[model samples]
Target: MDRLHSDPGLLVCPDFTNECYCASCVPFISATITKEQAAESLCLVWVATNDDLCIQWCHQLAEETCISAKQAQAAAAAEATHLHQVHQLEEEMAKADKQKKNRFKHTNILMCPCPDTNEEEAFVSDFVLQKIDKGHFIEFYYWTNIGLEEALFSYSTRDDEGLIPSEQDGATVWISAVASKPSKQVVPDRFLSPVDFAQAVPRVVAALKEHDWPNQWVLMLARFWVAIMTHQYWNSNDQIAQQALMIYQEEQQRAWHNAVVLGNGAWDLSIISNTVLGRLFDHVLCES
Candidate 1:
C-alpha cells in the first residue's frame, strides 16, 4: 500500500483469492508484487475499495482456497458439537433443528459492529432482531454514520416475558454491551459528524479490544450506496431521518415478542442512543 500510493502507478498482485486473482499477469501488469502477505491485506479491502493490482490478487486467492470432503465433514461435525446444546440433529433426513419450543426456554441473539460505521444506530433498529416467538431469524444490513468498529452492547436477562426493549413507549432498561470493557469518554450527548466521529473512534475502540470472539456477533455493512449520508445531507431537519428511527422501533417491538417466545430474557438487545438520525451532523461532509 505504501509503495503503491507513493508511486500511484505501482501495483502488486497477491496470490490470495480474496485479495487479487491474476498474479500470472504481474510481470506484464507493471505494479510492485508480493506472493503472500498477512490478513492486513484483507483489512484494507474491507475498509477501502481495491485498486487494479489488488483485484488480481483477490481473484487468485479466492480461486485456490477450497476444502476437501474430509475437512468439510470434520468442520460440520465441529459445528454440530458447538451447537449441540441449542440445536438437535434429526439423523433421518440429516437436518438440524432447534429443540421444541416447550423444550428450550430461550435462544440467544448475537450482534456486533457494522463495518460501514454510518449505520451504527440503524444496525439494531434497522436490522431489527427478533426471537422465534415473533418470527424467523433474519439478517440484514443498514447505513450508520459512526466509524468505530469495537463498540458492543447487549442485554443480560433472557427469561423475562417482556424484557426486550422495542420502540414502544414502555420498555426495560437496556445496557451497553462492552461497558465492562474500556472505551471512549464522551462528556455529553450531541449529534456528531464525521469530524466528531474521528474524535470518538479511539475511545470506542479501547472499550471493545479485549475480547476474543466466537460469541454471537452481528455486522451490518453498508457502502457508498447506502442512505446514511442522505440523512445528514438532504434531510437536515431529521424528520426524514426519523423514518429510519421508526423502522428501528418497530423492529424492537418485534424483537420483544420474539424474545418472549425464545425464552431469552436477559439475552435480548436494544439500541441506546444519545443522538438522533438527521442530515445535520457528520454525514454531510462525507456523503458523495
Candidate 2:
C-alpha cells in the first residue's frame, strides 16, 4: 500500500486469474492472498476507481474474497444468528408456538457502549442473544434509526457456545426478544454524494486516530466500503465500474456486520465515524 499510495503510475489488475506479463509483477501479486490482505486490497480497488483501474479490480476482489465459500459462510452465519433470535421472539409474541414459547427464555442482553463518549449515558440499544438448539449461538445488536429499529450487527459463534464462559466485567440484563425497536432512536434517513464522501475521509480518519480507535488498513478499507455502500452514491455510466461498485457495497456491509457481531458489542458509532461509511452516516443520520 505504501508503494501503491506513493506511486500514482501503478496499475491494478482486477483479473487476478490472468497471467501477469509485466516484469515488475511481484510473486505475492499472483499468489492466493489471505482474507486480511484481500480485505485491504478490496478497499484499494474501490478508491482506485477514482483514477480508472478500480472497477474491475473491485469486482474481482469481491468475487475472490467476499464471495468465497468460507467468507460467505461466515457472513451467512452472522446474519442467520441475528435473524433466528428475532424470529423466535416474534413467534412468542404472536402466541404462534405455545409449547416452544414456554421453553427456557435463553435470551440474554449483552450490554453495549453508549451512543456518546460518556459511559454514564444509558446504553439504550438492545441486543438479542441466544444459544441455538444445535449447540451453537448467535448475537445481534438492535437499534432504532429513521423511525425504525434495525439490526446493527450479527455474529455467529465459530467455537462451542457451552465452552465459552460468561462475560465478567459488565452487567447482564434479561429482556424478551419481543421488546420494542424504537426504545432509543439514533439513526435518521441519511444520504451522501461521491464528492461529499471523498472530502470527509480525511477528517474522519483524523478523528479516529485521535480517539485511539482501531484504524488498521484492513479494517479501514472494509469499513469505508461499508459506509459508501450503506447509502446512495452518485451514479455512473461505466458497466464494469457499476458491477464492482455493487459487489464492494455488499461485501462491506457483511464485513461491518460481522466485525461488530464478533467484537461482542465493542463497536460503536464513534469508531464508525472514523471510517468512510462514518462520513456518510454523519451527513445522513446525525443532526448538524
Candidate 3:
C-alpha cells in the first residue's frame, strides 16, 4: 500500500503496451494497479482495439468510476443531452443574428498594464471604456470586501419561492470595489469611461491590501474585474455575444441560487466570474 501510494504512476500502464490491454481485462490480477489506473488502462485498451474484451472492460471502468453501471449510463446520457441542448442554443442564436456578424468583436485593452506606469500598474484606457459602453451598458459597482451573506442582502430580494430572479439586465457592467470607504470620500454613481474606472482600481487594491484581505481574494477580485470588462465588451448586438451573455447570466443565477437558496453560502464568487472571463475571452479577443 505504501509503495502504491508513493509511486501511483507505476500502476499506470505505459503507452501501447500489452500490459495495458491485459490489465483492463483482469484489473484485480494486477496488484500494482489502482482502480483509477485500471480504468485509464481500459480506456487506452478500448481506443486501441474495440473488441469484446474492450467492451467488457469499458463497462468495468464505468462501474469503477461511478457508483454503478446504471448511474454511469445515466450520467453519460445527461451529458449527451446537455451537449445537444447547447448545440441547439448555438444554432438558434446563429440563425437569429444572421445579420449581426462581428457585432461583439472589439479590441480589449484592460487585460494588460498601462504602458505609461513603467509596467507597475494596470489601467483601463478611454478607448476600451468607450468600446465596452458603446450601446446601452448598465454599470454595476459591487463591494469586494463584504461577505456573501452581506452581498446577497444588499443586491437581491428573494421571492415567496425563495428564488432570486434570473432576469438580470444583459448590459450591466460589474465593477468590484471597496465599499467601506469613509463617508467623506466621494464615489461616482457611474464611471464615465474606462479611464475613470482605471483610476479607481489602485485605490481599491490599496484598501484591500491594507485591510489584510486574503491574497487569493484580492487576486480573484482582480481577475473577476477583467472578466467583467470582457463581458461588457462582448454583451453587444451580436447574436453569439448575446447568447453567450445569456448563458453567463444563467450561470450567475445558478451560482447565486446555490449559495443563498441552497444554504451553501460562502465566498464562491470566483466560480461564476471565472466562467464569464474564460468563455468570452477567446470569442471576443481571439477571433478574426
Report per-prediction Cα RMSD to one decimal.
Answer: 30.5, 33.2, 27.6
Model 2 local distance difference test score: 0.38
lDDT of each residue in 177-223, candidate 1, tens digit only:
33222334322212333344333332222222222222231111111
- Candidate 3 has a TM-score of 0.25
Model 3, residue 81: distance off in Å is: 38
Q: Select the stronger candidate by TM-score from 1 and 2.
A: 2
Whole-model alpha-carbon lDDT for candidate 3: 0.44
User: Which digits, one per residue and each the tens of the lDDT, describe model 3 over residues 10-53?
Assistant: 24444533554564456443678766566666667655544544
What are the models' TM-scores?
A: 0.19, 0.21, 0.25
lDDT of 2 by residue, 1-288 (tens): 211223333544354333442222333344576444554565566556646534444555666675597888998999999899899899877764654476446322212212233322212222222221111211111212211123222112212222323332365544424232232433211222343333333333333334344445334543544454443332545433333443334344455556665765433322333355344334443333
C-alpha RMSD in Å of predicted model 3 compared with the true structure: 27.6
Off by over 4 Å in 3: 1-192, 232-264, 271-288
What is the number of backbone collisions in each predicted candidate, taken in the order shown?
A: 44, 2, 0
In model 1, what lDDT does residue 115 have?
33
- How well does candidate 2 score on lDDT at residue 40? 54
Q: Which of the two candidates, 2 or 3, achieves a greater TM-score against the reference?
A: 3
- lDDT to native, each model: 0.35, 0.38, 0.44
